[model samples]
Target chain A: MRRVAIVQGEYHVVYQPGVVISTLLGSCVAACLQDPVARVGGMNHFLLGEPGADVPVNPADMQRYGVHAMELLINDLMKRGAQRSRLRGHLYGGANIVAGLGGIGTKNGQFARNFMRTEGIALDHCDLGGTQARKVEFMPYEGRVRATLVQDQPLPPVERPRPAPVAQPTGELELF
Target chain B: MPAASAIKVMVVDDQTSMRAMIRRALQDLGFKDIRDKAGPVEALAAIKADRVHLIISDYNMPDMDGLQFLEAVRQDPVIGKTVFIMLTGSADKEIVQKAAALGVNNYVVKPFAPAALKEKIERVFGELV
Candidate 1:
């Protein structure tokens, strides 16, 4: 049994022997994809909602971002002799902890789901949306994903304000 | 250089939680003096006066945007090259180009994982600390 810490800015691709790799997340997303039939899989914790966050020390930036992470996860598993046709995804996180941000969480979740769809990848499970954050664990060999929701208050139902009734103009209606 | 002291970082984001999170992330990485500001109105003056080794600022803000703040800082030779890292929500190519023109040292988009920020900050502060 090996326990590892995935620190900020650092990531790991563990070849666990039937063991699960886990990590904590909030707005940051973690994607777990596996080839169930082949029994090999991998996951990546992407920091931002999109690409371009990857900073290259020099002029050549690092090839790491949500989009890039997703692509890498698939490619790495494939390189390990996994079949792309038998692959499935499990995405987690994209919570909205900040106030008045009804769009951030939804947008991130949508982006992940859409990316999976656009790439012709099958997403078997997803534990996303809501104001709550999550901690996720994945077993690549078992093709299982576990997500635990964190301390987050339920978002109060939006209360739409009614517009004041417009008063009828008292001008003469002779023109009619 | 023999570990030129720990990096003293300052986080300036509009969201208090975000500022706190970034500060915590940096602190977890053993970075000291992780000062924070909710907006740039007060932060701009503080940047000019304070001896902050590095700055992680938000691009979109209610007051004084990140570009303006960076420009203002550049005007003064003191804090001009203060290892500026822009933490924003936008990843548009145009914005990235503009940020590069503004002399931004690094750009870490929002909704970033702790690991992601840690890597970038550590890389940027590798020399200072």
Candidate 2:
């Protein structure tokens, strides 16, 4: 069984992947975790590196930041019978799509890297930070991920534009 | 024309899936003569060649934009008198005014429910019934 989720805006979710926890990313980031031994895993998407001020969260906003999103994903796996020593992570999305954001994507990537290292989880593999939004399909059962990168701006009506060609750059935008 | 057969619709949008979705919604509402196009150019061709009674178009695209499409539709004598409806999320005053000037009958913004679209279509063409 496969399930898909489109993560955008002020949203946070937690799920145990009996199969997969799939999502897409723009200026956001998602951290995936798997307990190879326990065979338990899940993932999450957060809008920005810093969630900023004024947004109220259910439990607390302090632990809802970017750094904490990763921490939470990891800890969730551990709670599901994952040993900290055997847990592995894969990161996606921190694209420089929005130009002149003061290297916001780069900052997010660094935050994820530091958080992973600091938390003592061995970073098995990572594909992070680029200039494309990605559609990701993760198979927690077999620990496999299929990602699609759609390189086009969402033409929200406010920007009344012209006709367009349907040819899109579809490929493995990145692999890490 | 009677409301039962009063209006034919042309749905224009850049997203293939979204266009299909709008078409499905139109079908569910019993809108006959529902034709969909991905870009304004194709839509313009359809407008020029066909007897479209109404239009529902997405505002943002790469080729001919919604406003230009609407203008082209109005300029074409073949279907100039047909009503227009814009289904989009654009809040631009200039664009809206231009569409209004073109004699568009109605508009539906983005992130809308199917019932909302049905309501607008019903409102604009409701008297036909």
Scoring only the A-chain of each prediction against the true A-chain gives TM-scores of: 0.71, 0.71
Alpha-carbon deviation at B2 in model 2, angstroms: 4.5
What C-alpha lDDT values do all the predictions have? 0.63, 0.62
Q: What DockQ values do the models have?
A: 0.01, 0.01
Q: Which docking category, incorrect, acceptable, medium or high, applies to candidate 2?
A: incorrect
Off by over 4 Å in 2: A1-176, B1-6, B127-129
True interface contacts reproduced, per candidate: 0.00, 0.00
Could you list the iRMS of every candidate?
19.9, 19.1
Candidate 1 local lDDT, residue A118: 63
RMSD of each: 21.4, 20.1
What lDDT tens digits, residue by residue, belong to model 1 across residues A61-90? 222346545544554576576766687888
